[model samples]
Target: MAAIAALSQNERTLRYVIDLPISSTEYNIWKPLFKLFLSVKDDESTICGRILQSLTRRESDNSQISSYWSSMLENGLLSTLIQIFSLSKNDDALTSAFLIFLNLLNEVPQIKNDLDTIKNCFSSMLKHTRSTNNQILTLLGRVLSCLSTDKLLIDSMVEQGLIETLMILIDKQRSSQIIYPYFDCLANVIGKSYEYQRKFIYSKNFLLLIVRSYLQDYDLNLSLSVIRFIRQLVKNNEELQNILAHYGVCEHLLGALSASSKELQQVSIEAIQALSHKNQKVQQILLREHALEQLLNLLERTNMSTLQVAIVCTLWTLCENNPLQKRDVATKIGVRKLISFYTIKSDEHLLVVTDAINELAKCAASINMNIQEEINHAQGIPYLIRLLKSDNEMLVLSVLKNLQLITCAPGFIANRKNQEIIVKNDGIKLLVALMMHAKCDIIQVESAQSLACIALSNNQCSTLIESTLDFSYSHLVDLMHSNDVNVQLKASNALATFVYNNSRVQLFLKNHYQFSFDYFQKFLQNNNESIRCITAFQVVVFCGLINEQKQSVNTAVGCGILMDILRTSQIDDAKSAAAECVARLAHMKSGVPQAIIAVNVIDYLCNLFSSSNDTTIGNASVALGFLSHIPEGRRKLLNRSQTSSIRYFKVLSNNIERSRAAPLSDYEKEQSSTNIMNFYLPNIRQKV
Candidate 1:
């Protein structure tokens, strides 16, 4: 097998008109090829053409042959090729020289690490392109484009009349074999660096040629090259989309929709999408050209996700306020077909399909209907709900995102339809189940958000959710410590709603108060800032809403955590939450006020009274006024030590005479705490 492979390579090498050289400086591999160069003065063009062809072929194979050729060209052999190139008159040797320069300019400098050789070669090619030789001009055009990536080489090319020569070719040259290369050359040059792009962005003749010539051609390669060339012009150039539109380039891009090649179809559609992005008037022009119908037809013939994405991307631009396009897609492309493509595929395809669907949802929801009807028609709602139960974390995230967009997007009729679909497909229950997912925090977070979306709607949906299911409030209680801050936030958000004054919810919380408050204590002590914010939310929600949960079984540890967070947290949200929790507990007749004062809670509240933030100071004042209702708590609230005001309040529970003298009354407690709470609660809300 090895001998046969060698024979195949030998036969391939035998077809070359000149022997391949092996050395850069030495003539060891050069003797025979130089003999051929010396012997074939009349056919030097033929010999050089074959040599260039073999060099390109071996390099394409990515073998060591490119290195060998790089070594040969980096030495004296470069002058020999240039010499032979100058001697031939048919423009054949010029073509061969430019081809070598094209390949060698990209590969040789990279291999030899010689930029001066590249600069010298670029100067030679730039000089040659000024000739009336069309074939030589075509080859040198590619050479100039390839070398334009080097700032120094581009400077030299500009000095040596490269732009003038290209302008002449584009104005005079008619053959696509020549014009195709020049347009492709322009694309390469424009993509090199910002300087080249800036220089060319205003070149009217070059862009006109790019927009004009290839559309009339029968060749797919030429047409596709021109489309890509124009893409290079307008990609990030916000000003050039108008240039493309003014010269009718976008009209021709729309014409690329009928292309028989899938690759051309994809790129052309993408170019149109990129150009028409912020140019809404151009989108109206595309719609007037019936671009939406072409896109609908193309969307049906292809299963390629990329092409599908491109088609929808362009359609999204056209459909913003163009109700005609939206109605057309609804009746023709059939949103059900688009929805049915989601089968829990790879994450890449999921992102594409979901993005397209999201765009389509935005468009369709404006005039026609919500996206859920289409999803329901295709049974996508069921699959998406089942995907929520998937072990693949990415799939779960994708489904949650789609569900969130559909369920949360604004519009009464639209929100009703989407929430109805989720309920009908039992998606709400699945999402509730997903909240317990421990491995993927995104799933837990988004699932909680989706449930919030369903439960918080103002219609009868909340009542439907209230009667339908059994929730794992215990799981939510456990997830309060779920390592992920976002999970903790979302879980608390959902529990706040689930336990919103419903008797069963209160019973569940009353049963699990000890377990739930344990996470709150740990959360308040957590080092993470976000966890601390979550801890604050947890405290306020648990204490403010659930009167039974707030009727306080054990307030010692809870009081310490609340006071520590109030003292330690710099964020007003955390400090405010801790104060608010204490205020709520103090309002109840539980022994919370006695426990709070026993632990120097009065000192924390006194410090907050001097705080810069009005919200913290007010919350602290309300908590103190509520504490002042009790005989022992009243002494702490009123006491002012000679050293620091907060010091006497710190140990006021230990002073028996002061406690007996204060004899607190319920009327004073209710009136004072109510006035302080009413004053601060409004300010506290705006801060949170």
Candidate 2:
């Protein structure tokens, strides 16, 4: 059998396997061809690849070969194969062994306990790593890889110290033939436990070792391999940051930030971004090291791919922590450079440009020194306005959010002259259209935020913003309960800001007709912290109407439910807002507060006067003051001993003391403009 196997493996017959007829009964004639492969005299990789290729292709559905192979293995054939696999010096023998194992392992349970005997055959081969022949290790690694996904098989191999062996191979000096098999082994083991892989790769001290080796390595190929491994580590932000924090990575990364190769700079910047997010110390270190300037420089000169990645990372690290970071970027550059960069670049380059612009808008929210100046100078608003018509979901989101912020900036309204710029070029209508048409939750949430920003300036903007309020209410309400936490926060913010004005509130109630008070009632009882908190607050604000026209019986009943949500256990802001609504309702008409008491709202307001969270506390005070304005509301409070009003007054007094004592960050001051305009706008506009 060995001599016949040897006879068929000579150079002349390899062509025959490729040319063999699909139906040839001679297929079985090649069943023992692997034994011939084990004896071949060959140095060519192609011969090895070809023989394995023929075996794999033929073995595809060849159950006869499988059965025959199984019968051969069931006898003493396993020992001769083990001897050939161990003793053969030719790559062809190793390739044949790999193919045979691949076929056999597919029917792994058939090998059953005998599989251990076969695997034991490998214990001797692994010892051959000490030999000058590394192909044995490579081939063994490949054989193990084929079985790596089988938990039972891998667990057995691991018990025999296979992971330690594979790591040694991986940690060895680079050899082209050895590296691929090591990567394959790594991929297999990582697939076993991603967390375990991450721990080793991103360990605080070990990551520096990898980065230092990568930086000092003279070989570009080796450097790229190390980078690819590090890139996997960067996927875990906290892990990557913790690793980066162990060294002066900010300066190290900033030095490399300007590498002429775009790929190198991208990887370095990504690692820095990951680090910043992982540790606030990294962020402070970056800030101290002028990391933002280096990043901005990178943004200015970076290629499209690099710039997009840099912008995204910068935004994630900077804007995620403080809206002020976004504001600073906007105020410094005015978004003119960034917007013009996007406008002039080809559509293919637009993605990176869009990322920069989106981050700029988020940071710049209503903070530009001259909103109109920046918008006009960059030609930013018009380009973004046009993007409202874009088919791409992300583009629409970017455009909408920036435009929202731009339109909301103080003194952003266009006169007849700037009207073409503001309304036409920037396309306010398209943004309004998105309230109905956008399908993505992010786009919808951002669109709502945009609408809120646009409504910030004046009654004119409000009238236009109010037109979309019904559509906004429908989606905003749904998103307030979204599974995505960010969407829920953003939508809650949008509703709180936009719904504050009487025009939008009236428009939403009348048109969108928030008839499903029951849905909101259920949401208020939800276990989600943000949902319950924001929903409680927003429902109360919704109930308080300044110029609210009389509602139909159904709308009035919905209003009663709003009062109930406020009066429920742990009403917090909801209770305070409900009390304010009772005041507004009674003052608007006597019938409203009478209807509110029917829902038992006074007890709820009394409970919230002592609540934490400045919003609930302040609203409670204001609600008590408003209640003191209404005869029946005042009587209800007085009948409850008037201590509710006194407690609220105390809460208000304490809030003022805290406000005076607590200093705001630049971002806080920046964010304050939005809150100020949101809550105190009508009075401020009236005074103006």
Highest-TM-score candidate:
1
Q: What is candidate 1's lDDT per residue for 1-688, written digit by digit as tens?
A: 2122222434354433224443334434444444444344546445645554454555445565454464355445566655545444546556665676566766565633343454354445555655777777777666655565565555555655666666676777667766666666666666655566676656776667666765767687778777877777676666777777888987788877787888989879878876777677777778788888788888888888777767765776667564445545644655576666564344434543454555444321311244555665677666677667666677677678777656643211125566787888888667766765546766776776676566543335556654445545666666666777667766775675454333455566767575345556566666764455445544544564343354343334445567778778787656766765666456443344577688887777677655544345445555665566566666655453323544323322222222223323333344444433211112222243
**TM-score of candidate 1 against the unseen true structure:** 0.53
Q: TM-scores of the models, in the given order?
A: 0.53, 0.52
- Residue 22 error for model 2, in Å? 9.5
> Model 2: which ten-residue window has the lowest total lDDT?
677-686
Local distance difference test scores for all models: 0.59, 0.52
Off by over 4 Å in 1: 1-90, 99-117, 141-168, 192-195, 212-214, 259-263, 301-306, 320-332, 343-352, 355-399, 405-447, 451-688
lDDT, candidate 2, equals 0.52
Error of 2 at 637 (Å): 41
- Residue 35 accuracy (lDDT) in model 2: 45
Per-residue lDDT over 304-377 for candidate 2, one digit per residue giving the tens place of the 0 to 100 score: 75455465456446545644465465445445665665545346445545555554432111121334445566
Per-candidate count of clashing residue pairs (backbone under 3 Å): 0, 4
What does the lDDT read for residue 287 in candidate 2? 79
